[model samples]
Target: MEMNGSQRIEASREQVYAALNDVEVLRQCIPGCDSIEKTSDTEMNAKVTLRVGPVKASFTGKVTLSDLDPPNGYTISGEGSGGMAGFAKGGARVVLVPDGEATMLNYAVSAEIGGKIAQLGSRLIDGTAKKLAGDFFSKFSQIVGPQPAGDDAPAAEVAEKKGWVGRLRDSL
Candidate 1:
């Protein structure tokens, strides 16, 4: 399946980018995400529980970020196993564009599933993916608040200077 969309995030592009890379932020935003542990600068291990149609499964996965371009965006990819339920692999290209003091966040995602999950039919799988993506973005937008003029700081500064540690702190 493939899906794409854009959202107007009420935060600076830098701030949005920081949030996107923060494991804690992503853990909070992703639907049914139980945990996200950073394993490297560009990779993290994740556990998520998802329900599609009448089936529910817990998946363990590794998520990786590539093609980094600072506050602009990056490519995110991951694959997960659900044992007998199935397995899923997907990737997304995310781009962040500055819009005044806000940011325009766009994403294109491509995914595939096999085993029992694939047998559930495209309509069901597509609907579930869309719902999950929507849920993530809505939660993401809420956490990445618009910085007030007087108390604003670009998160990209932290990412560039102190790496993920500083970015994580700023994200929180």
Candidate 2:
């Protein structure tokens, strides 16, 4: 399957780029993510549970970041297996453009599945992928975007009080 879309984040390109690279931020943003651990600057391992159609399974995967351009963007790719449930692999090319104080995030995705999951039909699989992508970007934007008016806690202070995820959600 293939999909593409964009979002306007209420943050600078630098902030959005940094957050995209942060494993902790990704752990929170990804729907059904159990954990994400950074293995290297460009690699991560993740465990996620997903329900597609009537099949629910836990997936263990490795994600890689490539074609790096610092605050500009990068391509993210990954593949995972869920035993009899089947396997999935996909890649996304991401671009970040500065729009004044906000950043416009653009992405193009291509994915494929094999085994039992593929039998679920293209309509089901495509719908699931689109929903998952939307969920991920929406949460990511909310975390790294901007806080509402009258909220003035410094990020460090928020981190001290509520930890990294909270700080990212509330301050950064």
Candidate 3:
């Protein structure tokens, strides 16, 4: 599966970029993330527990950051195993663009699942992926500060914009 999206973070681009590289922040934001320890400037070990439908599993893995461009963006890739449960491998490229005092964070990611977990079907996986991504971004936006989680009402002028449709869909 693949996901690509963007959000306006209330923090500065530099601050957001630095926070993106911080394993502690990542652990705190990632749902089910149990622990993470940095092994080097670009590598870390992590443990996470995940539940989908009626199945639950604990995963252990190593994450590596590559193609760094400091205070701007980078690519992250990792592979994890969950014993008899399954295995997952994925990669994402995250970019930070300055937006006044805030940061416009964008990302594109791809992932593959295998073993028993893959048998659950794509609809479940797709829905869960959307939820997980929404949850993560919501938490991150909250931490970065005000996210205008305000009224979704759109002006007549905005109703004609393509992005306005997305905003309406997201609000739902």
Candidate 4:
């Protein structure tokens, strides 16, 4: 699956970038995330739990940031396993752009799963991923403050573009 989102943050570009890099902030921001800790400057570990259809499971994984352009952009990739349940791995490219008085936080994420999770089918996985992303940003905006311009059309477009299937399942 692929994902995209845009958030207007109250914090400055540097502050938002720093927060995005921080494991503590990310852990709190991620829906179902239990913990996140830095194992190294470029790598970190995370534990997240969620339910997809009838299956519920927890995942522990490692993530690493690559091709960083400090306070501007970078690619993050990670893989997590859930014992007999399944495994998930994905990468996301994040970019911070200045938009008038707010910083526009943009992300492009792609993810894949194997084992039981993949068997759940694409619709469930796609909706679940979309929900998770939406949950993360909704809370993130609360932390960053509100958008004064009041136009959220751009953000909605980004979210819709994430999936090829509009409703049940379209096509890629």
Model number with the top TM-score:
2
lDDT scores in order: 0.91, 0.91, 0.86, 0.85
lDDT of 1 by residue, 85-157 (tens): 9999999999999999899999999998998889999999999999998999987997897533542355444
TM-score of each: 0.84, 0.86, 0.82, 0.81
lDDT of 3 by residue, 39-122 (tens): 999999999999977779899999999999988899999999988989999999999998988889999999999988899998
Candidate 2, position 156, lDDT: 42
Q: Is candidate 2 or candidate 4 better by lDDT?
A: 2
Q: Write the per-residue lDDT of candidate 2 for residues 59-159, one digit (tens) a residue.
A: 89999999999899999999998889989899999999999999999999998899888999999998999899889988898789876455454644456
lDDT, candidate 1, at 72: 98
The residue pairs in collision within model 1 are none
Query: What would the per-residue lDDT of candidate 4 be over residues 1-172, giving only the tens digit for each residue?
Result: 8888787887778878788787877877898899999999899998999899999999999999998887897899999998889999999999999877678989999998999989999999999998888888777766565544546756556556765556325433
lDDT of 2: 0.91
Ranked by TM-score from best down, the candidates are: 2, 1, 3, 4
The parts of candidate 3 lying over 4 Å away from their true place are 146-172
